[model samples]
Target chain A: MTVATFEASAPFHIPRWLAPFVVLSFAYIAVPFIGTNYLFEAILLPFLALSLAGVGLNILTGYAGQVSLGSAAFLAVGAFAAYNFNLRIEGLPLIGSIILSGFVAAAIGIVFGLPSLRLKGFYLAVSTLAAQFFVQWALTKFSWFSNDSASGVIDAPSLSIAGIAFNGAVGRYIFSLTIVSLLTFFAYRLVSSQTGRNFIAVRDNETAARIIGVPVLKTKLIAFAISSFIIGVAGVLWAFTYLRTVEPAGFNLDRSFQILFIIILGGLASIRGAFFGAALLVVSPLILSRLGSFLFGDLFNSGVLDMSQRIVLGALIILFLILEPDGLVSLWDRIRKRSVARLNKRKHVGRAAQPTQ
Target chain B: MSGFDWQFFVEVLIGGLLSGVMYSLVAIGFVLIYKTSGVLNFAQGAMLLFAALTFVSLVERGVPFALALIITFAVMVVIGIAIERVVLRPLTNRSPMTLFMATLGLSYILEGAAQLIWGTQVHGLDLGIDDVPFEVGGVLISQFDLFAAAIAAALVLFLSVFFRYTRVGLAFRAVADDQFAALAVGLRLPRIWATVWAVAGLVALVAGLLWGARLGVQFSLSLVVLKALPVLVLGGFDSIPGAIVGGLLIGATEKLAEVYIGEYFGGGTESWFAYVVALAFLLIRPSGIFGQKLVERV
Candidate 1:
């Protein structure tokens, strides 16, 4: 073997081209110069935050095989907890507040994850709704969470690290990109570990996993802790970096459904599926509105467009579940394989025709 | 605090139990679908909303009440059949979660379609019963609530009779008992499922109209399904009797909580108290009071 040749084997069969260097340059370097203000503010900011949350949910529901419909509640907990930490502590930095808030949310996630030890399937899913309603009610009922603002909306703390402040869309985007990257990298490592295998074992068959000496309860709890910690951080990005404000209403059940839809549309159990799903989710509404305006010429207003979006989204979920349960990533894989096969056939025919010239 | 007002407590309990029958109406829809197919139909709320919206919109256009009911029922039947044929059929044998998600998608479709067809305006439905509370022995009760309670009891009675005496009902029970065995014995799975879904849709219509009259026909009507989840958690996913009892317990407890302890929590505990009761029940009895015990085989 050549000296330059090295080999590596990971448990996950990552399909293709999740190159760190290429993606980093495109996000941090190339985009800053070429992209417009609106692109950074409206599109990339929320997209990045949702991508982070999607990754968090995928870790739990996708990898761990325990479904949750209470993600928005966790997001709210993170946002509010971070808000409180930053507000109450005299000189704690914004980043410290975020990390601490993530731990708080993780603690709560474990509390709710207790139910999963006893329940399964729809039972677990339905009970999680308790988190959704209870969180929303508590946040709204207790004015203390919002610093007695009376409006129940709290402004996010100013973002600054050491001597640098995230002042505008580009600055905030870059700041969020840093945290999301670091966290996503840890998550990427997590799924490829032995703990991740134990999760899959528990998911596929709990009896078998238990028989084989897997600490089933701990694995599930760990999954919940890690997933909620990540989701909590994503909530920090969502409120402070993306929306610039936090409220209980902002992280309602609809937001949870949106995040769940992301993992499902992206492809469950795949890291990149989260990104693909987040991208489709962020982009599709823009596409739908554009298509609506172009085709109907104001005959279909925003309300009608909104309704159509719901219809389209619902139809896509059903269609995907029926036709392609593996999600958009699998569909991309199919197209890529077809083109590669075609190129191989063409290359062989070209070699035969030229007679090895 | 003040000499233990038994009369006031009993009044609240009666009112809650009566309102719970309304919740039971919705929970029954969920129980029907879950029993036969093992799919907890999240779209039950959207179906409720759709049915109410359809009936209200038709009535507003001057259609007779009886005629509007028939047309709405027909629409629900069509929707049930379409769901069975299009979504559930292709998705058969999948995990319960997968099927549940499909129904979640189905809810979105139904909610959107309901609004698209009938514009998004809230309509006040008058069910022709006087709503003013009448007092009897220092206790007050509304006539509309009694009317609703009576209808629910009738529905329960009719449903039990149908399940006991009808051929399709026997097939439904067979499928619910064991789908594989039912298929082995030549039971028509699709038809039974279709029938069950139709019955669920009918239940939704009944719930929607009652809830619509109480709260108005609007998008929030779909949220009634959220209330039903706790009832299912309390009663079990498969038993109709469980749904009714659970709903009654949830209704009585939530109302009681709101009146007694809502102030300590700054009021508005009604939104989530049922879920808490149901969740506590789950910790003690996972299958529910009347639900079949699930024995998991390796």
Candidate 2:
């Protein structure tokens, strides 16, 4: 594929990438207006929330070269913290509660990230499992997190901002879309910035990064902070917008693996890849179940269907690792490159004919 | 609070030590695969579940206990070889992260396959050991615990001797020490890997039987491996003895904490206390006790 270089003197010209993204953004905004309620609630809201979590994980694991298996812990922390902040503090707006929850999750993330300074590879990953189990335990053990609910489940308070209630599926979808878009925009800028370069350097080689004047420890911690902040917000969206009722059990080890799979399947370290991974994770099982029922009628029981889903998911992960480790984004890139090559060949032929004339 | 009951403490310690041997059994499987192939085999838990489920299901169908055990062992050996051929072989020379993820994928496949083959209902696995507690020196101990410990000891002894005396054992050690050197010496990497996986699978079966006897063969039987993570971290991932000693320590500490410290946190701290202990230990000694010092060259 050829790199598109913009002239330094060019003023106020949008990049070619922005054209497709702009159209996509408009369609995203129009979804609530044009699409069915089931499409908005059953599909898009959860996808957006999980996509944001995938983006957060991609920053730390993909860009910074850290493998964490405790992302669900941060999600749980974010959700519970937001719930507590909203419940205890009177008259505090939902936005403040959400941002506060993000900060809280970031702080905890930095604390857990400290072990990364000494541990590397699978060792660090195992240590992160401590956070996963510990967070889950804490949330369940203490009734304070769940507001002392008998069932240990907490309901999200109605979301409203500046006298406008974002309560229904449409409102929640728009709210989640706005939050995801803004966070994704920030993530794009962060990945391209000097700090982001430091993250890449640290991930590629910590010793080399340090020798070349990159602050390795700080870079790692910052990656954790930013990633957790985004993930925490995703957690808030997961609780308040998508599920609407939160339980600690919902954010289990499996959930963490699911998010990790999203980044892996979507294309690690790419912002667009997070969304792709989330969409696939959310939509594929539904499609697979539908196809399974249609194909086999009553022969395919739910238990068998569930088992098949897991087998398919596992096979897909292995296949992606073997065939395209860079994931679907790389596949898309290859296709685009081939088409671009063909277009350039046609253009060159046309120029040759014109010169002959 | 009634001045610490010494007898109760001793009882808890003894019970914890016995169960720790069970954890060690699972941890040994991890060490074997990791030592040979450098893969952290997260599927060890799933293997344990599959082994136990198969054995129990066979026994349920009126297969004698001994026959069921033999058949399960054969099935596990086939699985070990199949996994090595299909998954590990293709993904050789990848980063540890990639290998780790493959094991994670392997785990999902194993879990799903286990449930699909043997329905998800919980099953009772009786190894014929009586569960009645016997008193010795004012501390009560379960007869089953003693049996489990004996089995664990025998397994460890057999493994140590096997690794020390046999020709294949020498090849295994050589491969574990340096894969490239082993390859230069014409040792077939695939054969060694298949052997190590088979050994690990055998270890998982023993662990599964013991744990299944204690807790019943259920979906949660697989989750016992989570408790073994602390044992691996504390003992050092690559050391066999480390797994044993680490397992004992985690088991004792977990019981003691659950009995004493759990009250402050409203009980049930055993679920995560081991992980916290392991995390703290990692902060102090990143390589873990008895683990070879990792020397990184830039």
Interface RMSD of 2: 2.4
In Å, residue A227's CA in model 2 sits off its true spot by 1.2
lDDT of 2: 0.88
Error of 2 at A105 (Å): 0.4
Residue pairs clashing, model 2: none
Model 1 chain B poorest 10 in a row by lDDT: B289-298
- In the range A113-230, model 1's lDDT, one tens digit per residue, is 9988888777788888888888899999889999998768989888999979996889999999999999988988898899988888988889899999999999999999999999
Looking at model 1, residue A124 earns an lDDT score of: 84
Q: Name the TM-score of candidate 2.
A: 0.96
The residue-level lDDT of candidate 2 at B264 comes to 93
lDDT values, one for every candidate: 0.89, 0.88
